[model samples]
Target chain A: MDVAIIKYNAGNIRSVDHALKRLGVSAEITDDPDRIKAAERVIFPGVGEAVSTMAYLRERELDKLIAGLTQPVLGICLGQQLMCQWSEEGDTSCIGIFDQPVKQFPAHELKVPHMGWNSLDRLSGELFPESLLGSYVYFVHSYYVPECEDSAAVCNYIVPFSAAMQKGNFYATQFHPEKSGGPGQEILSNFLKL
Target chain B: MLAKRIIPCLDIRNGMTVKGINFENVVDVGDPVELGAKYAQEGADELVYLDITATHEGRKLFADLVGRIAEHLNIPFTVGGGINHVSDAGILLSAGADKVSINSSAVRDPDLLDRIAGGFGNQFVVVAIDAQFKDEKWTVFVNGGRIPTDKELFSWAHEAQERGAGEILFTSMNHDGTKDGYACEALKTLSEKLSIPVIASGGAGKEDHFVEVFQEGKADAALAASIFHYNEIPIPELKSYLKQNHINIR
Candidate 1:
């Protein structure tokens, strides 16, 4: 399958490309809108601040292009946050692909980023199979989307939040599937199959 | 639940895994990618590669090795050793290192932390502090625990956090290489003082030592080298032991 990973001013895009290569798929990392629209699959992966990232996306007109994608589009980490309606990080508005808002994890006894391996609960949608239920996936983020009607999975840190979400052709995960080990590999394979 | 992480640290010299990896049934033991893949298969949560090479060519070799490791392993990994500037960290991160750890360089120039965290987000930076207990006070040491700095342990760690460090990798020089146990008292104090995750390094002797580090130390993660590299304490057995001990483990 011809897969294209939308590249921008984001981090870890190389890691995501390596992950796809590990799964026997050579995905093109491109910023060209035509190639992104022509690919069979599109992956929006990033690791950066949300506000500045949104601004960059808008300046390049990639934000609208991403929201209009009708294929099996997957967003990872910061990519997922930018798909939401708005983000608390710098109080910036997002692409509005998912009817959710991103907010920072409340300051409490727990750590801010919620780093390391954390298990997912309430596995739903096509991105996660039954085998992924209660399986630990790697996570490294301070901001998260609250559990809602579109939540595909939930994870508890200081509070229960959306670990994965799916709506129409768009699917997203706050955790890094490329770095989540075996269970994470399975997730990427599932997305490829979709 | 967020599981406690088990990280196996590998020392890289001239772009090869060093300190004599003694794992049996392994080909090319000196190869970082091969050894790191094996650890990941054994249920290691993450890996740390400390590049001890000093030459410019050796740093380039280490970056190539980082890309090779990223292509082979699925879990996250951090690279450290001679990162003195933001561009140095940038090279490793672009080479597919999930995070770049700064040690002595960060001590010499604390702004290195801010520059890195600002350029690549705080989550991409790990501030590693090596401290030794002396004169009834814990003092920070730099240059691989060779030189002692005037900075205290708690205050320096707090400063790193304020400068936008995502995590703190604390290596108690006194407890390091002792094989008795981790500095639980110091680790608990660090965990309580900082809101970011604390990764305890240095002392890891046995399976029970891992338990003590996680349970009593309240560390977010535990890192060790010899015990894991030599197969003295296998990761699967240690993880199951932690599970039986009612500790949250992956």
Candidate 2:
């Protein structure tokens, strides 16, 4: 399978590529629009600041290219955050794949970056299979998108939020499956089968 | 709520894990991929591999080992020791490392923290502080604990957090390899001072020590090498002990 991970100067791509390799799928990390457009499965994976990443994506016209992709497109971590309408991280606008805005997690006796393994429930998306319901997956994020019409899975931190969101052909996860061990591997496998 | 992490730090010397081992099937316990996979299967929340190798060839072997381990394990992995620049940090991150830790380099060029946190995001940059208590203060030590610095451990941890380091891996030189106990006093001070997570390294003699670090020391994570590597403690049993003691651990 020609799995292509959209690359535009972001972190954590290597880990994602390596995860795919473990599943026996060699994903090509590329910025070339043709390759990304022609890919059987597209993954938009990133971990970085919102404004700068969006600026780079805009500079390379990747924002529009990614939005226009018709295949099974998966967004991860920062990629999922940017897929929303806006992000409070840097007061930046992002690709409006979902009609939601990403906001920073509230500091109500909880740490800023909700960093560690957490359980997922209310799973109801192609991205999250039944087996993964109530299973633990690694999550590390400060900004989050609250539960909305597009939420496929939900988790609670300081507030109830979308752990995984899907709309039509586009799917996104607020957590990094690449770092989430066994259940994470299963999540990726399910996404691939979709 | 984020679960408290248990990290096993293994030192790499001569392109091999130098922790004395006695596994029959393991020809060389230093094999990075084998050990990493083993720890993950055993329920280690995370694993840290520190390269203490001196030879240049060993550096290449270390990178190759990281690549192999990244392919095998399905957990968060962190690498540190002798990383001097963002480019070097980039090398390990590109080799499938989730986060790259900087110690001596972070002390020399403090702004390197900003650069790394900028390039890799704060979540991907970890600043490792090796500190020793002396003269009524926990003093910062760099260059593998050979040279002492004027920076206080508390202030340095606060600085790392302000400079956007995702986490602080604090190794207490006074407690390291002693198996006495974690520097709880220092850990409590650090946890109270900094908002970022503090990973307490050194002085883990028993499973009860892990509980003390979390409940009393206020540590976000506890790290030990000797107890785990030498089979004095097993990851699963230790986690069960922590859970039994009412500590939230993955």
Candidate 3:
């Protein structure tokens, strides 16, 4: 299957690329909209500031192109947040693909940036396999998408938030599947098969 | 509710897993990939690899080992030691590290933290602080606990956060490998002070120690090396105990 990983000014793209190579699938990492639209599957992965990242996507007009794609597009970490309607990080407007808004973790006594590995809970949606219920995945995020109509799984840190979401052809996860071990690979494999 | 985390730390020297007390009296553990996979299967929430070797040759080996482990296991991994440049961060993250931790390098150039956070996102940048108690004050240490910085712990931690560090991995050099328990007092102070998650490392010997760090210290995660390497406390058993103690674990 042809998997296109949208590449803007971000990190973790190479790791995701290597992961797909390990799965015996050749994937392309590009910022070009036409190449992304041509792929059977799309992987939107980012590790950077939300506003600047969104700006980079907008600069190339990949923002609208992404929203318009009919293929199954998967957004990871910051990519997932940008797929939402808006984000508070940079007071930025997003793709509005999902109805939820990405908000920063409450700067209370609890930690603002929830790093490390945590398990998925209260999973829903057909994209996830039965074996994936209650499975642990690696997550590193400061802002999260609150539980909304598209939530596939939820994770809590100070407060609960959507860890994974699936709305129409777009499937996004706040967790890094490429970095997450076994269960993570399973999720990636599922996405590939889809 | 938020699920609690269990992390296994592997100390690598010359491409081999090593464990020691007080960061000395080192003893070889085993292969990193084997141990890492074991922890993953045993229900470890995450794995941290610290390369203790200081030579250029050792770094190449560490990178190779990280790649081997990443290919073998499906879990989140953090890599640290001898990381001073954005290229180093890029190398490790590309090799499958979920996060690249900076210590002495970040202290030398705070802008390095900003550069990394800008390049890799703050979420992937972890600032590891090795603090020692001296003159009734917590002092930050560099060069693998060899050099002490005059800067106070609280201020350094705040600077790290302001520079966009995602989390702070605090290791009390005074309590490391002592097996007495975590430096709860220090951890609690930092945990309460910082807005980012604090991972309490060093001196975890028993399962209850994990509970103590979370309950009393308010640490987001607890990291240990010897206990896990020697099989003194299995990851699954530790998780079970944490669960029984009403702590979240998966």
Candidate 4:
């Protein structure tokens, strides 16, 4: 499959590239909208602050291009957050793909960033299956998308939030499927099949 | 609820996993990559590879091995020890390292924390502090615990956080290799003082010791080497024990 990873000033796209390569699919990391739009599949993988990432995307005019793509696009971590309408981190506006605003996890007995392996249940969409229910996937973000219509999977930390979201041709995961071992590989494989 | 992490720390010397107690003993427990995969499959939340090599050649080998390991493993793996420049971290990150930890170098240039946080994200930079109790106070040690610094442990941890460390890996030099128990008192105080997650390292002999670290020490994670390496305490059994004890574990 011809896959392109959106390159911007965000978090590790290389890891996503490597993850695909592990599954025998070599993906191109490109900021050029033509390359991304032409690919059969596109991945928007990121790990950066929302405002700066949005600025990078908007400055290069890739934001508009990404919003226009009809191919299956998988967004991971910060990519998922930016796909939302807005984010509380850095108080920045986002691409509004999911029509939900991201907010910081409420202050509770648990710490922020919610780092480490957590269980993902309530599998509800094509990106995941019943096999992944109650499976432990990795998570390391403070901001989360609330339980929305786009939510494909849910994980509880400070509160139950969207672990994975699917809207039209766009599928996103607040958790890093690229780094979640075998289950992670399965999620990526499922996206590719779509 | 977030699960408390159980991390297995592997000490590498001359590209081989060695015993934490003695540097000279190059214990062929197994290749680090394979061992890391084993632990991950058996339910280890994270893995830390501490390359104790001081030579430039060893750093290259470590970086290359990290790439190979990253290809096979799908968990959060931290590459630590002997980070001289910011580019070193970049190289590792490109090679698929989730996070790069620096102790002596971060101590020398405290601003590296902010710089790394700005360049990469704060979650990608881990500040590892080795502390030894001396003169009635815990003092920071650098250069493989060979040189003692005037800086106190508590203040340095606070500074590291302010400088943009996502997490602190605090190792108790006095408790290391002893396997008695973790320095729970110090860990508790450090966790209470800092808002970031604190990973308690150094001494872990039994499963109960891990229980103590999470419950009493209040550590977000606990790291041990020989106990897990030697099979004295397998990760699956340990995790089950922790679960039985009402500790949140994956």
Angstrom error at residue A19, model 4: 2.0
Model 2 spans with C-alpha error above 4 angstroms: B20-28
Candidate 1: regions farther than 4 A off: B20-29
Q: Write the per-residue lDDT of candidate 4 for residues B1-250, one digit (tens) a residue.
A: 6789998988877677777455664666668888888998898888999888879888888888888888777788998987778788888888888888889999898888888888888889889999999778999999878899888999999999888888999999999888899999999999998878899998899999999999999999999888888899999999999999999887
Best DockQ among the predictions, by candidate number: 1
Write the number of the candidate with greater lDDT, choosing between 1 and 3.
1
In terms of lDDT, model 1 sits at: 0.91
Local accuracy by lDDT, each model:
0.91, 0.86, 0.85, 0.88
For candidate 2 chain B, the 10 contiguous residues with the lowest summed lDDT are B20-29
Best by lDDT: 1
Name the candidate, 1 or 3, with the larger DockQ value. Answer: 1
Q: What digit string (tens of lDDT, one per residue) describes model 3 on residues B35-125?
A: 8888888888778998989899999999999888777666677899998899999889778787888999999898999999888778788
Error of 2 at B2 (Å): 1.6
Q: What is the TM-score of each candidate against the true structure?
A: 0.98, 0.95, 0.90, 0.95
lDDT (0-100) at residue B87 of candidate 4? 84
Error of 3 at A41 (Å): 1.6
Using lDDT as the yardstick, the better of models 1 and 4 is: 1
- The fnat scores of all predictions, in order, read 0.93, 0.58, 0.63, 0.63
- The most accurate candidate by TM-score is 1
Supply candidate 2's per-residue lDDT for B231: 87
- Listed per model in order, the count of residue pairs whose N, CA or C atoms clash below 3 Å is 0, 1, 3, 1
Q: Tell me the DockQ of each model, to 2 decimals.
A: 0.91, 0.66, 0.54, 0.68
lDDT of 4 at B122: 83
